[model samples]
Target chain A: MVDLTHTLSPEFPFLPVEGKTFPFRSSPIATIKGDGVYANRWELTEHVGTHLDAPCHFAEGAMAIEAIPLETLFVPLAVVSIAERVATNPDTTLGAGDLMRWEKDHGEIPARAAVFLHTGWDVRTKEPGAFVNMDGAKTMRFPGFSDKAIEFLLGRRSISGIGIDTLSIDPGRDKEYAVHKELFRAGKWAVECVANLSRVPATGAFVFVAPVKVAGASGAPARIVAVW
Target chain B: MVDLTHTLSPEFPFLPVEGKTFPFRSSPIATIKGDGVYANRWELTEHVGTHLDAPCHFAEGAMAIEAIPLETLFVPLAVVSIAERVATNPDTTLGAGDLMRWEKDHGEIPARAAVFLHTGWDVRTKEPGAFVNMDGAKTMRFPGFSDKAIEFLLGRRSISGIGIDTLSIDPGRDKEYAVHKELFRAGKWAVECVANLSRVPATGAFVFVAPVKVAGASGAPARIVAVW
Candidate 1:
């Protein structure tokens, strides 16, 4: 089994917010000095660190994180590496052609499987500024799937969801978040900020995306693992 | 796969604290009506609802939630039902005798396997006061593993950890929290407030306790599931 989740901490960057960003605070709720026990309270956003974005994140009245089927959370994993391209162009978006090329080597992506885009961005997770990659104009930049790519994955392959090492399934520069809408509209979910994808084989790994079961919430932090 | 986690919400009871208790507050960070996206932020304790108790939760310099081994997180599950006793006497604790009886029916508890105690306490999870079951002196009463049972499991069987359907693995009335200390000192973990243990067979199921990967934190909320 390989852990495909980033350890959530205060340093893990949150998506740029206009008003109030989600907070991740950890304080000792009980300490050995006072309470004779050691425990903590974590107050954070549902989307902190490695997380799952349920359909409700984009589509109103859609299934929340709790409503996601247990069977769908565990699926065959298909990883497509685009690290080389992302190394040069941070705005690199995975296209349908990339999927076709990967299929040539890894066979067809099975139905109801999860497709993860490995841009090697997880290496920068420890450096919050680099992970977020905000430009001079304050616009973030990162790799994500193209709208056409997501549409193809949904319409042709019937995928359960898509995952990425970056903060979003859509490129940070995307103002409309087209990929998110396209995927969520198809009743699919997204797993973001996944770590250690390079350790997993391109095919044949079973991914477990276990999200904190927040009732009726749009999304929640998740612990993702892969077993072969 | 059976979901052994409860739906986390504001109504769910939190562990009583001297100053403040578990506060589950969720608000829309971005709404479709305003921001063209539906997202929310949540603030709560790491021990809220169904969660894993990392070794650091009790023992200093011990493994935090992120440091728990993946192999230990997934293991053979052994369910021991004491629902009848717990129904009549809420303070009933699982003792070494219970483990012996369970082994009598099934085989010996396997090494590094997770044992679950089903006390039928999940039925009260919806009722805040009933789940806490605080007496007149403000002492909470619930079923948990006794020190003898934990010692037997750790020393004799060399089990991975134990889980309970109550708010904690230690009976709420115990001030010393001896069970927690013993398990943590042995480098074992605990899954607390798990739901739907009755759905899983007494043996033969593989339990997955996937906690939110809070870096260096004592514990975190988990999504526990069992596959048969």
Candidate 2:
């Protein structure tokens, strides 16, 4: 068993959307010394940390976080690594050619699989500034799956979803977020900022994308686990 | 697969702790109509709808929500139905004798299992008035596990936790919450207001109590699931 979630806190890096920042915050509401029990009040953006993006995040009139089917939550995981390329070029994307090569070596991508791009990006998680690396023009840099790669997975492989070990499934420099649209338009979900993909094998392991059942929300932080 | 989670919303029944009420709230921060992508900001108390109580919730120095070991999350689910008894007595409690009877018929309770008391309380979820069932003196009435039952499970079986289909693992009328203290003191956890427990079998199905990894918080809402 392995946990692929980041511990959500105010200190964790959050993506600024449209110049607005919604950070994760928690404060003690009850304490053993004060109230004889412990609990917290938490506030967060739906997309922070290791979270699952419901189809409604980008696709119009799609299912919200609560409406996602339970049957699709458990899925076969296919790990495709781009760490070697990402080590030299942080701007690299896992293109369609990579998926083809993966199928050539590992037979065919299984049905109902969540193909995760292991960019080795989680190595920078501890260093917030490095994790959200931005160039001189204020554009972030990280490896992600190419839109064509996502299209192939959706059209040919019949996958349940795609996951990535980065801030977004689209390469960080992407301003259009075309990949998110493609995936959500097909009513498929996604996971972002996934951790410890290196521990999982290329195939055989299954994952549970268990997001908190928030009603009518675009997404929520999830506790994703893999078991064989 | 069965999702043992209740969708969290502002309308859900939340247990008031020491006269404080923390309600779940979600509002759209970005909408597809304006922002092209959709998302929401959510605020919640950790103990709200379908939540897990980390050991630290009562045990002063026990593990927090983020530090809970992954090994303990995947557990063999042992469903012990008390729905029949609860049908007549709304304030019924599942006693230790019930556990003995369960073992006599199904053999010894398995190690590392989550034993759930299905009280059929979820049928009243749509009615907050009856769900909380507060009396003139402001005392709530619901089904829960008896402290003796929890003590027996902790001592005799290497169990992960105890769960209930009602507002708490302790009887709703319990002012002292003795059952909570007994279970938490043993470094075990609990789930409250779990949904769809009746769909699970007596034994054989394994569950994953996947709580959102809130950093250093006492507990968090969990999306628990069972698979056969």
Who wins the DockQ comparison?
Answer: 2
- Candidate 2 structure quality by residue, lDDT tens digits, B9-68: 999988876655567888888889998989888888888889899989988898888887
Kindly report which residue pairs in candidate 2 clash with one another. Answer: none
Query: How would you encode candidate 1's per-residue C-alpha lDDT over B1-228 as one tens digit per residue?
Result: 899999999888888887756557787778888888888777787788899999988898889988899999989999999998987898889999999999999999877799999999998998989999999999999989999999889878978888998988999898888999999999999988899998999999999999999888888889999998
Native-to-model Cα distance after best TM-score fit, residue B182 in candidate 1, in Å: 1.0
TM-score of chain B of 1: 0.98
TM-score of chain A of 2: 0.97
Number of the top-ranking candidate, with lDDT as the measure = 1
Write down the worst ten-residue block by lDDT for model 1 chain B.
B18-27
- Per-residue lDDT tens digits for candidate 2, residues A1-228, read 889898888888878666545678888887899989888888888999999999999899998988988878898999999999999999999999999998899879888888999999987888888989988999999888888898788878788888999999999999899999999989999999999999999989998899999888899999999888
Question: Each predicted complex: what DockQ?
Answer: 0.80, 0.85
CA shift at A79, candidate 2, in angstroms? 0.3
**CAPRI quality band, candidate 2:** high
